[model samples]
Target: MNLNFDFTEKRVIITAFFCMAFTIANLITVKVINIGFLGMETPAGVLIYPLVYILTNVIADVYGEKIAQRTIILGLCVDILFVFMTTLILFLPSPAYYTGDSSLAFVFTQTPRILVASYISYLIGNFVNARITAKVNEGKEYSSTKNLGILAFSELIDNFVFIGLAFVGVFAVTDILIMIVSHWILSLIWSAIAQPFTKMTVKWAEKGKPAEA
Candidate 1:
């Protein structure tokens, strides 16, 4: 909120907030929901995951690529650690009065393959988004706001990497096709939503600085 300042504590707090949201979104989106009305499937994380990428892109495009890269690495680490912790929590004892119940246990199965896929998908998708955003903004004096192309490109990278790593050979071609379209369309909407917020953050970051002075 303090646009005129570059306080270390402030940046740290904000960074932590975004990182937590991204990590949590990764956790809860493991369930693939089939829409009852549209007869379509989509990631529960779709509601929040693109926002994470949008944040990283803005960080890379505005502050610097180093920051963006660090954010991705740190975010991945947090997500990985949290998942393991959650698995452990589930392993802990429930009340002795209740016999073992498989009803909910199936959801938190914590298979090795699932863990590996999640890690790979998140890292690859996030890194790709950061790289593209930074590259596109490179050598430009000021932000151009004409970044709709980034939406499509980011979604493509995220979708392909995630689909290949996580869902490859596990689903039909038609299923993959649906995912691609969903990611692309959702990303476009997300990018549009984030554009103004990103511009504001950048301008604030540049505040108190002269034009090339």
Candidate 2:
């Protein structure tokens, strides 16, 4: 059976594709990625996750928080789909190339605790970032430096929630605190650097929105 999907006026599909790509790449990099910045070691994961946030922000800027919230829900749905599919595949018989289920376990066996944390934190933090950006724009603070405050605060929460979920107890408490701080700070830096580009992206989107009507 063939399903005729609507591509025109399909912002949800577009946003979901980008978010899925970001999530896949972010998952890969989270295992081992660190760099020293501002006398702190930061995870390279920030490079990818903030893009997701920026996309959400741009969605909110051009469309509205309602659409941005929809995108966040889309992300959560995709994550759940991944979890379910992986679990189903892991149970199936393996081919000869695979010695055992190690690879399956590696991919699908994230602790339930971590999975729950990741799901909750990601949905909350992402919506937080997008909502703040949307609110500021709606309030006509787009031209003010207060817009930067939106970025700073939201990115901090984004990084905090993500890193804390990804490695709250996996590392020592002290190391986890430092890592959380580093991830948060690095995300803030990326948000600032990317906000200008986001304005451009949002402007481009706005131009197209009226055309779609």
Candidate 3:
């Protein structure tokens, strides 16, 4: 039996690994930073969260749906493990001389509502993004426009689910609406801005391979 390993395959695996790591890290620190503008508030996670979708699209485009789905599931599992570990750490008594304990707790101690929201939003968003991208790519070459459209819808769903679930009772109705709209719009714009880089990544990943139909 003969086995083949290639640079492009290695790049795809590395990219997927980083994307999964980023997703978990971003979720963990999502509440660490909050910003307000135009009388609306949103978590700093917005800036980095779109990369997860972008990378997932690239994987689905260059590799396949199965790999992308597996990546998303892997990310979810990592996130769960991260949450569990952080919770355990939060429970342990801080060293008497460790001055950063408060800061660490402040950053890692997520409320139950926010944690649930993060899980729901991420699973639904990444799954939908990967599925839609795969379905669109079937027998068709990559289309940034179509991909953007799919991503926009998926992000909208993600923002709605996350904000609604996390802050429905904690914030006023209007504020929640603002958060959803702001997050959805910003995420769409971020993905659009990153489209060129995504194309480059996909092209790089697909190098030395037959072009898709």
Q: Pick the candidate with the highest lDDT.
A: 3
**Clash numbers, per candidate:** 0, 0, 0
Best by TM-score: 3
Q: Measured by C-alpha RMSD in angstroms, how accurate is candidate 3?
A: 4.0
Give the runs in model 3 whose Cα sits over 4 Å from its true position: 1-8, 11-37, 210-213
lDDT of each: 0.68, 0.68, 0.78
Which residue pairs does candidate 1 place in steric collision? none
The digit string of per-residue lDDT tens for model 3 on 1-213 reads 433436566555656565565555455555644455576556778777888888878777777888888878777777777778877887888778888877878887788887888879888988898898888897687888998888899889888998899889888998899878988888899999988887887776676665542
Q: Candidate 1's residue-wise lDDT over 1-213, tens digit each?
A: 654455344346446866887876766676776756456677677777777776776667665678888987888778778777767767788887876546446655556765676667667777777777778888674453545566567667767776666776888878887777776676677777777776776566545544442
- Residue 21 in candidate 3, Cα distance off native in Å: 5.2
After superposing candidate 2 on the true structure, give the runs of residues whose Cα lies further than 4 Å from its correct spot. 1-14, 36-44, 97-101, 139-148, 165-170, 211-213
Please write out the lDDT profile of model 2 over residues 138-159, one tens digit for every residue: 7352442555576667766755
Q: Per-prediction TM-score, please?
A: 0.80, 0.78, 0.85
Worst 10 residues of 3 by lDDT: 1-10
Q: Which pairs clash in the backbone of model 3?
A: none
What's the true lDDT of residue 9 in model 2? 43
Give the per-residue Cα lDDT of candidate 2 at 78.
Answer: 74
